[model samples]
Every structure is written in structure tokens, then in C-alpha cells.
Target chain A: MNFSSKILEDAVNEMSQLPGVGKRTALRFVLHLMRQPEQQTDQLSTALTRMRHDLKFCKKCHNVSDGDLCEICSSPKRDETIVCVVEDIRDVMAIENTSQYRGLYHVLGGKISPMDGIGPQDLKVRSLVERIKKDGVQEIIFALSPTIEGDTTNFYIFKQLEGIDIRTSTIARGIAVGDELEFADEVTLGRSIAQRVPYESSIKN
Target chain B: MNFSSKILEDAVNEMSQLPGVGKRTALRFVLHLMRQPEQQTDQLSTALTRMRHDLKFCKKCHNVSDGDLCEICSSPKRDETIVCVVEDIRDVMAIENTSQYRGLYHVLGGKISPMDGIGPQDLKVRSLVERIKKDGVQEIIFALSPTIEGDTTNFYIFKQLEGIDIRTSTIARGIAVGDELEFADEVTLGRSIAQRVPYESSIKN
Candidate 1:
């Protein structure tokens, strides 16, 4: 797409660099910004710049934070002994919304995707190990997604805690609460049956 | 969606103010920025700010431009007697891509939409009329989309040029190229049949 103005072209080019955004969508976004008041653009720019420059990560859990520790990590009410391991801060938010887990979270930042050149070293694995040792975390919940990369990251972290005396468990894989059993995928259904719990335990909650 | 950092939340909030962007997608964009190097965020913010602050519109046609006159308006090779009226710069780009029209364009910025409280006075109608009279344009072509608002805008402009000695025409509305006639909508098919051109004219370049 040809643009009459170099400034518009530059803005579109930069916007198109985002994941999943194409030239046309970027152009739409740029044109929309141009139509809005100058103050809107200024606010957007200031917010993004401030976010990039001032945002910090929790020193303990690696979750995004404005200070040295994230809200969950700093909260005294959350269980420090049971730490849930996840791939990113978004996952932390998702789990937090459920209100089912009251423990702290360890955001790994990303999964072990060898195809993407992201190895164990690229993640916060070392810090997580040191965190477990330093905090004496008793129960570690592997809340990573059910994918090959997620499994690989989980196993890598499990191996890192080999010498430690901690009980590690993964989140359950089963059909959704309201979904029909017939529509459940074969792998998940099989796993649900294989890992079936006693009826009493299942209803305990 | 909850955000761990206030800066991150502000960025997401501002980003989500864009058309079609929701809080979830905004969060994704914010998180993606956080994962990249700080330079990437800086470039994006700077480009957008520069575009908003430094961009200019063509004084004649109202299309986005780096100078007072747009490329098309400034080019001596373009036909000065023929003007294609469009809704915005995007329409100008679309028409330019065809490479068939070598005439100048007048961007109205937007169509008359009572639902949106947009009227002819809010557009560049007065400037367009003044330009036509000053330049002695011989023909006017309306290339707006086939919508109620588009038709209303075209009619409004046509009424404005009622006493002027100029020929006015609208873009031909017919079944799209490669579209099956059987699949064509009733109104379009009827219009295409009623407005059928001579066989020689249809086959002519």
C-alpha cells in the first residue's frame, strides 16, 4: 500500500511489526489515530513509553509489577508454601480470576519451544529453582498448558528440582464442567479416566 | 482482565480505546511489547507520536499529505479538468491502485450520516465547490461506497453543483468481476440488467 506521507508510512510500518497485524490493519489503526484528537495519541504514546521504561518484574515470582514484588507475591494472605508454575503473567491473571487457587505464582515467561529457539536458559528457570530453595516451597503446581512445549517446560523444571524435597503436581486434564462428554477429545477423555479420582474426593469440594 | 502493573494497565486501556480492540487483545499487545526489547516499544511510540504531530493534509483535496499539496494535486501530468470525489484518502489509494484514472481527486473526509451526526457542513463540500469553480473542472465522478450515507452525500454534492456547467457521473454498480450471476443479490442483478451498456462499449478498454 502506497502512502502519500512519509510519517504515515513510518507509523504503519512500525505498527505492522506487531504479531498477527498486517499492512491493511496497521493502516486502519494509523488512520484511526490520525482522525482522533492529538491528546489521544499523546496519551497512548506516553502510556506505552512509561510502561516500557518503568515496568518491573517481581523479584521472587517474575510476574509483572510496579515494584520489586508483585501484588500476589507481596500479599501475606496468599499461601507461600504452594507455588503454581505458569508460562506468563496472563496465565497468572486467568488463575487469579477463578479464585480457586490462593497460592503464589511463578511466571516462566514462555514455554520451552525449541522450534522458536526458546530454551530453558531463555526462561526464568534458574530464578524459579533458587526461589523454591530460598522460600522452602512445599507443593509446586504445574499449571502450564497441555501442549508439547508446555510439557517439555514442565519436565525441565521438574528435573531442576530433583534433589529438593517438594511434591509437584500438574493441573487436571478433563472435559469442561458444562461440556458434553461425547464432544470431549479422545486424549483428554482417556486421561480423565486414567487419572480418575474417588467419587468422595471429587465431591469433597 | 486484571493487570499486575499500573503502567501495563494504562497502556492496555489506551490501546483498547482503538476501534475493534478489546481489553484482551490490548493486554496481548501490551504483553507482546513487554517481551520485546525496550527499543521496539520506543520506536513504535516515537513513530506514532511523530505521525500524529507532524502529519499534514493537502490544502486542496484534504487528503493526507506531507505538504500543502498532495502528490496527485501537484503532478502536472494528472488531468485538471476531471475530479474523482471520494470519502477519504483510503479511497484515493484504492482508485490510484487501478492505474486507469489519471485525474485528480477531492477527498470529502466522510459521508453524510445523520445517525452519526455528520452533515455536509462538517465535510469539505464548500472547499470542493470553490475548487471546481476556480479550476473550471469539466467533469465530476462520485466514487463513494454503495450505501445510504454515500448516496445522500453524492446527491447533496450534486445539488450544490446544479447551476455549474459540468457533467456528473457515479461509479458503475454491477456484479463484481468473477462473481457468479446466480449468486448476485436481487437489487444488484436488476440494476446491472437495467443499466446494461452496449456490447461494444462493454468490451471496450
Candidate 2:
């Protein structure tokens, strides 16, 4: 009874690794895939491989870019005097969709969590500091998540940039508590950016 | 080394056939599956083979059942005279989820289509007509989609039931014109069932 086609079992094995996927789900998902047009499956495989290969971190901002300098960092239309700091490239895309923030972005690549063994130096913090110093950026906004790790990273960043001639702020507290920036609906994320508050103001309180 | 995994590739090929998945997606899906705990994959494989093997169409209403009759069709609690005719078992599950419907169901297997060469006889229409006559049903509700094929099937069934004591009706008109019954939201589907108008009355208008 256990004898089944090996490829299906093998495909099912690989599918089970995705976030939220279990073995049963992997089988169903694989079966669902089996019913589609051949080209559709090919396209999905290409997209996944391309997502891994074609995309690279921009040298300037650490955001995903096809080139050395990310599009936003390299674009002349962007405001070099203001930099928005975020956890990942998705955050950069989230901010770009608002059409409200014309400033550039610096992706930290990840948050600082001592418990998980992640530290500030392990992130792109050095590059962000370098960008602020050389690009003549007057404002550096910490648009990182509001988690404990996020807060720790934000303050660590703030202390690093304290001597620099730039101001620092964060997106407002209006976002639902425990909300990650990624899942915030466009309207909520936009409103939060619009209502950004001074980083030191929160620190003093 | 073109030692590319053959079983993995064949599994991906099979998965790429699903409704929305492509080969690329199938590869990722298969890769995800490959990473699962071994027994989990084994159980999933068992379920896939079992779903096809253990499940059989009920002789009374054509819905997938383990034995001669499905749960709803066999249950003494259901309204036997009030039959809801649907495209397949998915529709049966959809109606069952609401817990509001008390009528037994007749799964037509599929709708009529000249292009596909599927006609009334190709479906379980003859079985449905036989059940209607044998059961002396008082009401027959057509719950097919709003497509031309579904309409054609409904009209064909309506004509077949002529001179019977049954009152023929189709699910109401407000549902989006071309949507299948499988995709409609529960509220819309339930409302359609509740507001069903008489077939003769709609045809007259």
C-alpha cells in the first residue's frame, strides 16, 4: 500500500518546507500544481529561481536591485538629504508605493536580536552610517518594526548617528500594536509615515 | 553532470498541471515537499490514493460516498422530497457548510456543453431524473452555475421533469452572471438558495 510514484513523493517532500506548509498541504498543493498548464509551472519555477539569482542587494542602500546601486538610491529624482531606514527591501517597496516619501532607503537586512545571536554589526548599519555621512543626508528616519528587537536596533542606530549633523524620527505609534510594517494595509502604512514623530521625543518620554 | 534528478522532475511535471501552478511554482512546491518529515509525506500519499479509492459516487444522488449512499442522501433527517441539484461534490460540501440547508442533494457530475461534447446523457442527468420519479420529490432546485452550459443543463432537466408533481426552481438571479457555484461566497450562495424563484415564472418573464 505504501508503494506510490517516487517523483510525487519527492515533490511533496520539497513543498513541505515553505512557511505554513505541512506534508498534507504539500501533497494537495502538488496535486493542485499537477492540474495546471505546463507553461504555468515552468513560469513559477523560473520566477523562484530568478527571485534567488537575478535579485541582488544594492551597494548603495542594501535593497534588492538588479544593479550595483538600487534604483531608488541611484535615481536623481530621490532626495539625498533624507534617508528612510527599514528592515528589508519589501519595506522599501512598501514605502515607495505611498508616493508620499520621496527620500531614499537603507535596508538593515535584519533586526538586532541578542537572543537570536544577531547584532548591530551583523546588519548593514556600517553602510547606513557611511551613506548619511557622504550623501549629506540631514534626516534619517528609522522605519523599522516596533518589536523589541526593532526598538533596540533603532536606538543602537540612533546612538551611532548621534554625532552626525542629521535628525532622526520614526513612523508614528498609530499602527496597531504588534503589527509588522509588511502586513499593514497601504492606507495604515501611509498614514503612519505621514504622522512620523521625532525619535528623541519618544526616547525622552 | 546532467545527473538531474528524474523522479523530482517528473513529480514537478505532474504538479505543473494544476489550475494556477506553473513548472517554476511546481519545482518550488516539490522542493518544499521534499523537506517534510518522512511520515507526514507518507500519510499525505496515503490520503491522495485513498481519496480516489475509498470515495465512490452514491447511487441515489451521485455524490461521492463511501458506500451505496452519501451521508446526506442516506440520512433519515434530510428532506428527501426537496432535492438540490448541483454540479459536483464540491457544491455538496459548500451547501453542507452553511448547516441551514436540509434538502438532499443530487450531484450531476458536470454540466452540458456541445463544444466539449458533454450532453445530458453524459452527465448523471438520467440518474437524477430516475431519482426524482422514484423518490416522488416535490421540489427540485437547480444549483448549477450561470454559464450557458449550466443554463442549458437546467432547461434540459426542467423539460425532463414535465408532468411530474415536482415544483422546479433555480437558484436566484442576483449572483454574478457567469460565476460558478463553487466560487460564490457562502452568503451569496445561501441567499440564492433562499430567494430562488420558480423556474416557470422566470421563463414566462
Candidate 3:
């Protein structure tokens, strides 16, 4: 490959890195751009630059936000007392679209996976515990995935919330193996939230 | 759905209109945007607006160009006499990537598909004929697709150049049905260019 060809190849490589874009698809995309009016090409470049510069994580929920907090966190319409604990902001968004649960959310950043070197300390477990102890939260629902790591994270949270009178629950319905919450359809997501079960039996207490 | 939910649904609908994005994928994309750091979301909106304002086509080659002519058509290194005719600017970029051809290009805008309501005059065919006759060109290679519309377009152009002495040809080999030029591998594209086959001989004397 010559110098110019290398540049074209580099462009294709960068494009293929985006989600759902393979080599052939990347090539097709780049060719589409080349076919577009000059304005369209500029739009994509400017969009990337702007996205890198302007986006920030919400200080409260860790979701993407324009200001100090996310739109959901700031909205008065949400049930602030019922907080849904999730692994990431994508989960927050997923639940939002379902219109199933009208409550606030707490993004954990990620699950507790010690094998990948991620532990309870690495997640927002501390923040979550702090939020529960400090705020007047009535129910803390674990809306995390059904994976082993997700289960471990849920248990870890369950242990910490033991003494509190507030209800501790996990979204107990309709999550499949290795399938992400972000991909769940509205019907399934709605059903799961509606059918949440208590995390503890509290035998003979 | 409430009024706000309706707006969100429309946003998803707009995204799903793109070639590969389905409703599920569209929902994912919209939810991603709703969760976007305000900056990224704003950037996407801004980019869409800016593109509509800034992009335009080059008058000479009809490829997307910032200036009056596309970079390839304006470059001094490209051969003026050998004009490679294509269906769109995307096809132009594909041939340019081969780096084996230094010739200029003429975009036909689209193929001649009567069933789809596209005709010769509807394309850049007349302008191509004019360019060849006025510029005293030696060759015009048909780099359009191998489909029915592509064949129709090819025959239409051949008839238009009936009186001209200039040699007209196409990239000779290594492409299959439903194969897009953008997806073909580099080696295959190179071989196709090398094996140039002549069209039906003897135009009007």
C-alpha cells in the first residue's frame, strides 16, 4: 500500500471499531461518506469531536449528563425513595425506555468481578451504601444482570443493607444467561420490574 | 405513551430509517442518546443541522467536494483523457483506493432503471457525452454494477457514444452477483482492473 492508500485504510480501521461495524461494513460506510456531500463528511467528524469534548458523567447517578445531575436524577416526577441499582448507565437508559418503573437509579459503574481484577472497592458500592444510609430510601431494588458477577454484586449489597428496615429486593423475573439488560425488550423489562422478589426470607425472626 | 414518550419514540423511528438499524437497534441508539453526556447528544443534533447547511456536490465530476470540484478531479496528477464512469461517488472512492488508476472520473449519479423510474436524461449521461465530445477523451470505462439497472445504464451510455472513436471498456473480472464494489477485497479489485475487456466493437464510422 502507498502513502495515500494507508490513509484510506486507517480511516476504514477507525470506522470498523464502532459498534456493529465490521470490515466490509466499515468499507461500505466510508464509501458512503465519500459519496455524500461535503457537509455530511464534516457532520460525522464534528460530531465525534463534540462528543469527546462535551459529554460528562452525572455526579449523582454516573449517567451521562449535561449538568451536575442527569435528567432522571433531577426530575421531580420520579419516585426518589425507590432506587434501582444497576451496573451501568446503559441499564439506567434501558429501564427508562420501558416506562415500567418510575423511580430514581443508581449506576454501579460495573459488577464485582475479581477475576477481571474488578472488586467491590472498584465499583460504586461505597457510594450506594452511603446513599442508603444518608437518604430516606424506602426500597433499594437490584436491577443488575443475572450473571454470576451480577449475583455476587447483589449479595454484597444485600449483606450491607441488612440492619435497615427498608425493603431489599432484586428484579427476580425474566433475565436470560449472558444477555445484557440493555438489549431487553420493553415487555420483558416491564415484567421483570413488576415481579421483583424480596432478597431475604428472614427465617423465624 | 405520554407526549414525552411519543417524542422519544419518534427519535427512535428516525434512527431506524437508516439502512441497517432496526427498531430494537434504534431503541438502543435513542436510549444511548437520552443517556448521552449532554455534550454528545448536543453534538449529534448539531452535526445533523450543520451537515444540511454545509455539504454540496462538485460541479465538474459530481462527487462530494468542499470546493467547486472534488479533490480527485482537481488534482493535477490524475489523467484527464481517461474518464472512469460510475453510478455514484461511492464507486469513485472504491476505484481510487486501488491506487493503480491515476485517471479522472465522471459520476453518473445513478443507474438507468426504468422500472424504478430512473432514465438516461435523469442521470449525468448527457453531461458525460458532452464531456467526452468537448474534451476530446480517449476512453470511458464503465465501472457501474453488474445488475440489470447497471447493464441498462451501460447500454444507454454505449448508444450515446456511438459516433465517437474513443475506446469504452469495463473492469473485466472477479465480481459476483449481489457483490458491492465497496465490499470486494483489494486483490480481487486489482485483478478486475488488470483484466480489462473490450465492449462490442465498431461504433458508427
Candidate 4:
């Protein structure tokens, strides 16, 4: 699209660089911003710039933070020894939102995807190992997705724990809580049956 | 969702204020920005802030511009006597993209929507009339949408141009070029039949 103003074109171009936003959507966003007060645009730009400039990564979990340690890691109430492993901070946030687990997190930054040229070394794998060896982490829970990359990363980490004295586990896989059994995929339904928990154990939760 | 950092939370809140973006989507955009180099974030913020700060509206046409007059208004090649009235700059861009209209534009800024408390006075309607009278315009085309508000705005402007010598017209309403007749809405289909042009003229176009 031909923009009449260089500034408008530049702003739309930058906005379109975001994931899921196309050129037309970017133009819409730019025009929306134009309709608002100048202060609103200033506030948005200031927040993003400051966040990018001063944002810090937690030294232990690699989650975004304002200082050396993240809020979860620094909180005394959270379980330090039971660390949940995940692909990124988004997973960390999702698991945290559940309030089901009280453990700390270990963010891998991204999964080990060979197709994307991302290997174990490209993530926080080394630091996780060092953390397991140095910290008295009793249990490491794999909370990654059920995708191939998630499985590969889980296996890679499992091998890394060969000599370590830590109990490792993965999140349960089954039909979702509210989903109909008839609609469940064949693999998931079969796995749910094969790995079925005892009635008493399942009811305990 | 709880964010680990104040900066991250603030940025997410600001980003989520945009239309159609929820908190989760905001976090995704924020994280995507976080993964990129700081320069990208700087560039985006700079472009937005600069555009908002230094942007100007064209004096003659009221379209977005960097100077007193917009590019379209200043271009001698465009027909100054034939002005196409539109709702906003986006409409202007859309018509320009067709590469068909060579007329100048008059952006109304918005349509007449009583439900939204927007009336004729809230728009650039007065200036449009002044331009038509002062520029010796021969014709004025209403390119507004077919929505109730769009029609109301067009009629209101048409009434304002009653005493003027210029002829007035609206963009044609018909089934879209590639649309199926069976799927067309009742109103559009009826309008297409009632406003049918001479077959020879339609074929020539």
C-alpha cells in the first residue's frame, strides 16, 4: 500500500514486523493510534522502550525480571527444590496461573528443534544441569508441550540427569477435564487408557 | 496473569489497550520483542513516537501529512475539480490503490453516528463545503460506505452542497466483481437490479 506520509509508512512497517500482524492490520493499528490522544501514543512508546532497555533476566530461571532473581525464585513461599521445566516464560506464566503447583521454574528459552537449528546448547540446558547439581533440587517436572520438540527436549534433559539423584516426572496426558471422550484423539485416548491411574489416586486430586 | 517484572507488566498493559489484543496476546508480542535485539524495539518505539509527535494534517484535504498540504492536494496531475469525499485516510488509500480515480479527496474524519454522539459538526464537513465552493469544483463524489451512518453523512453533506453549482454522485452499489448472485444479500441484490446501468456502458467498462 502507498502511504502518503513517510512517518506513517515507517510506523506501519515497524508494527507489521510483529507476529500475526499483517500490513493491513498494521495500518489499522497505526490509524487507531492516530485517533487517540498524543499522550496515549507517548505512553505506549515509553513503556515498550523502557521495558526493552531495562528488562533483566532472572539469573536462575531465565524468566523476565527487574533484577537478578525473578519474583517466583525470590519468594520464600515457593518450593525451590521442586523445579518445573518448560520451553519458555509463557509456559511458566501458564503453569503459575493454574496455582496447582508451588514449585519454582526453569525456562529453557525454547525447545530443541533441529529443523530450526536450535540445539540444547542454544537454550538454558547447561545452566539447568548446573542448577540441579548445585541446588538441592529433589524433583524436576517436565511441563513442556506434547509436541515432538517437547519430547526431544525432555529426553535430552533426562539423559543429562543420568548421574544426578533427582526424581523426574511429566505432566499427565489425557482427555482435557471438560472434553468429551468420544472426541478425544486416538493416541491420547489409548494412552489415557493404558496409563490410567487407580480410581482412589485419581479422586485424591 | 501475574508477570515477574513490573516493566513487563506495564508494557503488557499498554500493549493490550490496542483493539483485539488481549493480555495473553500482549505477552506474546512482548516476548517476541524481548527475543529480538534491543535495536528493533528502539526502532519501533522511535517510529511511533516520532510519527505521533511530528505528524501534520493536510490544510486543504485534512488527510495525514508531513507538511501543510498533502501529496494528493499538491499534485498537479490530480483533478482538483472532481473531489471524492471519504470517511478517513484509509478510504483515501484504498481508492488510490485501485489506480482508477485521479480526483482530489476530502476526508470527513468519520461518519455521522448519533449512537456514538458523532454528528456533522464533529467531522470536517464544513471545510469540505468551503473547499467545494472555493476550488471551483465541478463534481463531488460520495465514496462513503453503505452503512446507515455512512448514508446519513452523505445525505447531510449533500444537503450542505444544495446551493452550490457542482453535480454530486455516489460510488456504485452492486454485486462485487467475483461474488455469486445467490449469495448476495437481499438489499444489495435489489439495489443492483434497481440501479442497473445500460448493458453497453457496463460492457464498455
Top of the candidates by TM-score:
4
Candidate RMSDs in Å, in order, are 1.7, 13.2, 9.0, 1.2
lDDT of 4 by residue, A1-205 (tens): 9788999999999999999999998888888888899998999999999999999999999998899999999999998899999988888888888889998999998999999999999999999999999999999999999999999999999999999999999999999999999999999999999889999988876
Estimate every model's Cα lDDT from 0 to 1: 0.92, 0.72, 0.71, 0.93
Worst-scoring 10-residue span by lDDT in model 3 chain A: A1-10
Tens digits of lDDT, candidate 2, B132-191: 888889899999987889989999999988887889887766667678889988877887
Q: Candidate 1, residues B51-146: lDDT per residue as tens digits?
A: 999999999999888888988889999999999999989999888888889999999999999999999999999999999999989999999999
Model 4: per-residue Cα lDDT at residue A75: 96
Choose 1 or 2, whichever is better by DockQ: 1
**Backbone clashes, candidate 4:** 0
lDDT of candidate 1 over A65-139, digit per residue (tens)? 999999888999999999999998999999888878999999888999989999999999999999899998999
DockQ of 1: 0.81
Candidate 1 ranges with C-alpha deviation above 4 Å:
A198-205, B200-205
lDDT by residue (A1-205, candidate 2, tens digit) is 1102344545556556564566666766655555445455555454444434444567888765667776677888889888999996557756776677988888897899999899988999998888888878999889998789998999999998877888898876677767787888886788778887789875753
**Where does candidate 2 chain A have its weakest 10-residue lDDT segment?**
A1-10
Ordered by DockQ, highest first, the candidates read: 4, 1, 3, 2
Supply DockQ values for each candidate: 0.81, 0.05, 0.10, 0.85
Badly placed stretches (over 4 Å) of model 4 are none
Q: Model 4: which docking level applies?
A: high
> Which of the predicted structures, 1 or 3, would earn the higher TM-score when compared with the native?
1
Model 4, range B128-166, lDDT digits (tens) per residue? 999888889999999999999999999999999898899
User: TM-score of chain B only, all predictions?
Assistant: 0.94, 0.81, 0.79, 0.97
Candidate 2 regions off by >4 Å?
A: A1-3, A175-205, B1-205
Please give the lDDT score at residue B80 for candidate 1. 95
Interface RMSD of 2: 12.5
Question: In terms of TM-score, how similar is model 2 to the real structure?
Answer: 0.48
